[model samples]
Target: MKLTVLGYLGGYPSHGGGTSSYLLESNGFKLLIDFGSGALLSLEKVTDPLTIDAMILTHYHNDHIADVGVMQYYWQLHAERPKEAVLPIYGHREDIQHFDSLEWSGATQKVAYKPEEKLNLGPYQITFMKTHHPVTAYALRILEIKTGKILVFTADSAYFDGLIDICQDADLLITDTNFFANKVGQKWHMTTFETGRLASQANVKRLLLSHLPEIADQDRLVQETIQALNKPIQVQTAKTRLAIEI
Candidate 1:
């Protein structure tokens, strides 16, 4: 099993085209986390564009869903005909409707898979927990059933109670650390210190931080977060094009 960091940022780049998207591959089954701004460009760097099985939207944010049209068109133009029959897109009901209206230049089918409370997708037994965000955001706990890899992706949320339990024992806790410690309350995103505390309390095996807003100082945030948390949790910033075997 492996997790590839495609575009690793909370917001769009100044020059554009960096992936906030992520791809998870296990036993040749591929699933995408969120399709942020640079999704198509990043996916092309990893595997054949047609091999993508499905996409899971964390929320309705543009940075997370902007590339949906582009990807659909790519698959329609390329890929074998049989593989392009239809694509399963899993997300909240609102998110599904939002993207379906797009005029994608693709001769493919779009299938929407709503949570309907919770459901199992292949090896992933997933449950969408409530999160603190302006929109209807969800915290996803994906269990890689065969290897017992527990991953928690708290898609773009402000810190909230019970978050520790939601992320407890996670093999990898991919939290949204969109700002520095003192930069809390600037918006709905979590501060660095807050993310560190959550990872420590959750006892995650490894903590990979992402969704970084460009205006903060990365060095100071890492140092301060390490000191505040005081745990051996592997806290590190995510980089684009980096792949980690989980």
Candidate 2:
């Protein structure tokens, strides 16, 4: 399984970056995890937008789904689009208005994913866990069926005990590290220290700090996470176009 960082900055994009978006591929099947601000332009640098097999969203937050409208426009008007192409956009049904927007004419289809059920899409088997966020966001655990590799993404959340179990033994854990270590008692996103604690307790092989703060010194965020870790583990900050194989 291969994972590519299309965009990683949290909240609003800055410094030529975009907010939370990733591409996961296995056996030529491309699965787009989110379509945040600036994501379409970044995605074009790697592959054709029309080539994306499917898309999934963790919640309806603007930073997470900002480019979804533009993506629909691309599928609707792109000259090279296939005649019968319809992209399946998987999203939770908690927000009916945003979920309805997932479908755009014949270009896209809205598919509701229940947190209680497991979903099989192409080469991956996915399970969802509701996250501790202001909105009804979900964390995803994707398992590559053929390779037995697991990739977990904590879309957006505050630290919660359940997360440790959901993320346990993952080959890669992409966490929502939207705040620095000093910021605490917030409910929207995880801090650098909290992220490191989760990764260490879960015993994930590798940790990728994503959904990053735009203005903070990114290197310091990584260093803080490393210092907070209970044991040694591979840690890296998410950057556009950064690709990793699991």
Candidate 3:
């Protein structure tokens, strides 16, 4: 299984960075995790947008789904598109308005996903866990069926005890580190301290700090996490086009 960081900045694009987005691939199948601001442009640098097999959204935030409409437009007007081709966008139905907008004419299909059910898409088996955010969001655990490699995405959430179990033994844990270690008592996103603690307690093999804050020093976030962990582990900050194999 291979994972690529398309965009990693938390809320908005700055310093030539985009918001949260990722691409996961296995056995020639491409799965897009989010389509945040500047994501489509970044994605075009790697692969054709029409080639994406499916997209799963964690929530309806603009930073997370900003380019979704443009993506539909791209498929609708692209001359090279197959006549029967249609993109499947997987999302929760908690926000009916946003969920309904996922379907765009015949260009895309909206597929609802329940947190309780497991999803089988291409070469992966996925499970969802609801996150503690203002809006309904879900963290995803994706397992490569053939390789048994696990990848967990924390999506957007605050620190919670359930996250440890959800990320347990994951080969890669991509966490939402949207705040510094000093920022505490927040309910929307995790801090570097919480991210480090989760990765350590969950025993993840490798850690990728994503959904990053735009103003903070990126290296310091990594260093703080390492200090909080107090252990040797392969840790890295997410950057556009950074690819890893698991």
Candidate 4:
């Protein structure tokens, strides 16, 4: 299994950065998690848009779904091959209009998912857990069926005990750490301290700190995260890719 960090900027992007997005590949199948702002441009650098098998939207937040419409149009722009099939996009029902916008290009199929739901796609078995965010966001627990290796993505959320259990024994934890340690109780997001704490408690094999807001200092965050853990962690952004043999 291989996972590429396409973009990790939070609500807004920095001069040359972008919001949350990741490319996960397992058993020759490609899947995109969140099409945040600037994600389309970053995605082109890693692989052909035409090759993506599916996309999952964790929520309707602008930073997370900004490129959803554009992704659909990317298909129609290729006139030679005449890509007719709609891309399968999984999202929540609360944001139907955002998903529907893809229909304008006639190149997307919307698949709604409920919080705490479970489903299978290719070689991955995925479970979605409701998160503590103002809007409906979900944390994902994905298991690679062939190897029993698991990955948990804490889409965007405040700290909660459920997250610990949901992420238990994950091979990797890709978490959203948008705020500083001072903002611990906020409802919409999590702090760097909480991000590291959750990973430590869950005992995940590896932790990838992401969803970083541009204003925060990366070095400081990494230092603080390290102070909170006994294991190794990586501060990742676009093009930072990791391959795991499960």
The lDDT, on a scale of 0 to 1, for candidate 4 is 0.79
The candidate 4 region of ten consecutive residues with least summed lDDT is 237-246
Q: All candidates' lDDT scores? A: 0.77, 0.93, 0.93, 0.79
TM-score of each: 0.90, 0.98, 0.98, 0.90
1-246 per-residue lDDT for model 3 (tens digits)? 999899999888998889999999999999999899999999999999999999999999999999999999999999789889999999999999999999998799999998899999999999999999999999999999999999999999999999999999999999999998888564599988999999999999999999988887888999999987855668999999999998
lDDT of 4 at 189: 77
Off by over 4 Å in 4: 82-84, 102-105, 184-187, 230-246
| Candidate 2 Cα errors over 4 Å, as ranges | none
**Candidate 2: worst 10 consecutive residues by lDDT?**
179-188
Writing each residue's lDDT as its tens digit, candidate 4 over 211-233 gives 88787777777767767775765
Name the regions of candidate 3 deviating beyond 4 angstroms: none
Relative to the true structure, candidate 1 reaches a TM of 0.90
Residue 25 displacement (Å), model 2: 0.8
Pick out the ten consecutive residues of candidate 3 with the lowest summed lDDT: 178-187
